[model samples]
Target: MEKLRYERPVINKIKAGVPDKFGMSTRINTITEIEGIPVKDIIKGYGSPVFVLSESKIRDTYHEAYRAFSTRYPKIQFSWSYKTNYLDAVCKIYHSEGSWAEVVSGFEYDKAIANDVDGGKILFNGPDKSDADLIKAIENKSFIHIDHFDELYSIIRISGNLKLKAKVAIRVNMDTGIYPQWDRFGFNYENGEAWNALNRIMLSNNLELVGLHTHIGTYILSANAYGIAASKLSELAVRVHRKFNHHIKYIDMGGGFASKNTLKGAYLPGKDTCPSFDDYAESITSAIINSEIQPDHLPTLFLETGRAMIDDAAYILGTVLANKRLTSARRSTIVDIGINCHWSLMIIGH
Candidate 1:
């Protein structure tokens, strides 16, 4: 019998108005294969809804971010943010690229340690840090970014009692003309809170203030905001140097870089609209390079970007289990993957 060659008749009326945003025609960007293995072959072997991460894309994005900073600034460090995607494979890829671990929780910290990240290289940042957590951080000689006064006091007491000096930085929150400012996470820069926090840390002999940290917001499209943030951090660094004669080892502009996934109500697609690595590099590096801080004293730049680095490389491939018609006859796809499993998928579709 002759084989039947059946193809789905996909037809639609051509719409007008905005041209192709990506400058490419609207077509199915299908993934027929991966890593020399056909998609069908993979499905036959593993099953549907299996996640397929492209090692190439992961390395490429990491290189992109690394190059952006390393080329612009002399000293730069990238700490892989754990909360973004703690998959062992994903973390290993980043670690292999020489990225230190940037974890937000005790669990993530433990995971980083297990991943073979050096204790001194791991950066501990978050609002909630248990007593046991502080002890671990101090003992391991990790860089702890203090979020609140209570945490600072706790760390000081722990350091004093244990006779151990803890390397630390203050998470400073600044307004950079962005709505829904992230003031809750760190000490405010405009207000004297950040200064006050710095003073307290400096006064404590057990706490070695090592750097300045700030994460303005997430999915931030405004590159200029980074410029403003960098300027504010530089100002703090200069003030600390002038008064206390202390030079921080680094300045951390914590990750808020948008991934290639459109946010809800976003007019332009993120892949096209989101600021590129170059844009972020320009804003942040320019501010630091232009700051009054001496060139020789320019602290290392640390980026805690997680989403932008791994979102594109990781894909949740799911088979269409069922297709139903909506009330308006629009198509609704039910795949093997759900919202819980593929949180980033919803962001892309939006």
Candidate 2:
């Protein structure tokens, strides 16, 4: 006779209260496999606490997002954001898919160059670009997104000294009906600071303002917020063309497209609550198309969507380390996966 399998005893106490709003019992499903491979087999071979990324999923997500925006806008380009996941394999996959590199620091810039991405295709963005970084970017003919006034002056001074014209864009921060505004990274749009910066750039002989960039916020739930942001940037572009007679090359709606990850205090799952790519594309494209800017002179749409593009393509596999009962007799299962496994959750406080 076979020995009886061991099992842990679990006790539950029903509390009297309002039932779940959805009128459905919450169920926990067990994940037994991933990408046709058994989870246990993978853990046996590679050990626990491993990360698995699906190449097909990445391509699918990218094409889905591309289709969403390209169908609405005439010209659209995607620059894979490096800060999201800088693993060489991940970067190469995006590069192979015809994505330009969008890096936020000197190290990431170098990584993009090392990955054989065309320097001109790279969009350099962030607040802490060093003089050396600017020089390298200028030499590579990269599109440097100026973050603050100091960076603008630094780029101007460097370009003047090198006798080279720096292809650049100014990062604009504006009110998009979102709370906890990210006004620290770029010039304010409503207060005329962004316009002032553009004026300064236009007057400079070495700096050529080819584009306008803005990243409203991260994991933004409202797609209308993006529409408002696009409208403001489009207005600025029209103003620039009117004053300088130079049409901007592109309008970079910087990343922060929300991924399908549930927030901490959410009423529904992210899959049900988060906006889809098509939703976001419609909001942003419609705003630009309806703006005062001429249709014939419409600029290229550049998106640096990071989280929404890659988050779902990757999964971290871990094992249950222990099970415990709290003082209130609540059950808790501790897993081997560390905080690093779900870094984005920490970022969004999920």
Candidate 3:
């Protein structure tokens, strides 16, 4: 007879009158393999605390998101957010999928260029752009999303000095009924600040107001918020056309679409609670289509989805270091992974 397999004995103290949250199933799910490779074998070869990314998953996710938007909107463009994962291979995958580069800093802008992404296809965003960065963006003919009046004036000066029309857009922040509103980055929409910035840009004559951009917030749970943002951006586009007789080329709804990751203190898993790609696409596209903007002159819809696109495609493998019993007889398990692992998964809840 074969020897009995060794098993670690576990004892449980049951508390009466308490029900398990996961009905009938108390065992936690275990990840044994990824992309047909055994986890143990991978760990044996690469050691513990290794990061693994699935190329196929990344491509598939990109296609899924692209299809969601492209099928709904007449014209749609996706600019891969560089800050999410600036790894060369990751960026190349997106670029191969026909995504433009959306960088938030000078380093990312350079990374996009190094990746051979056409400078014209890069969308430069963020609030800390240096004067040199502005010059490079203008020289490359990239679309620069102005975050404040100072950046706006800097771009105007750069364009005047270089004698090149800087293609630009104003980053608009609005009240989308989300808590802890992200009012720090861009011009506010409600208090007429966004319109005021647009007026200044139009008056400058050196900068071409190419688009209207807004990123409501991150891990945005409400799809209706995007609809509201789309409507507001559409209103701005219409106003710009009417006032200056110049059609805005695009409306960039900067990405904050939530990935399928559970948030702390949540009753339901994020996989079940988060809005699907179709849900977001429908909300945004429908609003723009139903807006006051003319159908024939509808601006191109641009998305810079980052977390939702790449989060699920990557996983960090780590070993459990030790297990011990606490003073209350509760089990405590320590793993090799640390806060560093959590950095990449930021905005994506565990």
Clashing pairs in 3: none
lDDT of 2 by residue, 1-350 (tens): 55877988766666343336653234345787776778777778777788778787888899999999999999999999999999888888888988999999999999999999999999999999999999999989999999999899999999999999999999999999998899999899999999999999999999899999999988999999999999999999999999999899999999888899766555567788899999999999999999989989999999999999988887777889999989987788899888566422101000
**1 against 3, candidate with superior lDDT:** 3
Worst 10 residues of 3 by lDDT: 341-350
Cα deviation in Å at residue 26, candidate 1?
11
Worst 10 residues of 2 by lDDT: 341-350
Name the lDDT of candidate 2: 0.89
User: What's each prediction's clash count?
Assistant: 0, 0, 0
Over 4 Å off in model 1, which ranges?
1-11, 17-28, 342-350
Reference-based lDDT, residue 124, model 3: 96
When superposed on Cα atoms, how far off is each prediction in RMSD?
4.4, 4.6, 4.2
lDDT of 1 by residue, 1-350 (tens): 55877856656658553545454334436777666667766667666667777777889899999898889999999999999988777888889999999999999999999999999999999999999999999999999999999999999999999999999999999899998888999899998999999999999989999999999988899999999999999999999999999898899999999998766555556688999999999999999999989998999999999899988876666687887879996667788886566432211110
Tell me the spans in candidate 3 whose CA falls farther than 4 Å from its real position.
1-5, 12-28, 341-350
Clash total of candidate 1: 0
The models' CA-based lDDT, in order, is 0.88, 0.89, 0.89
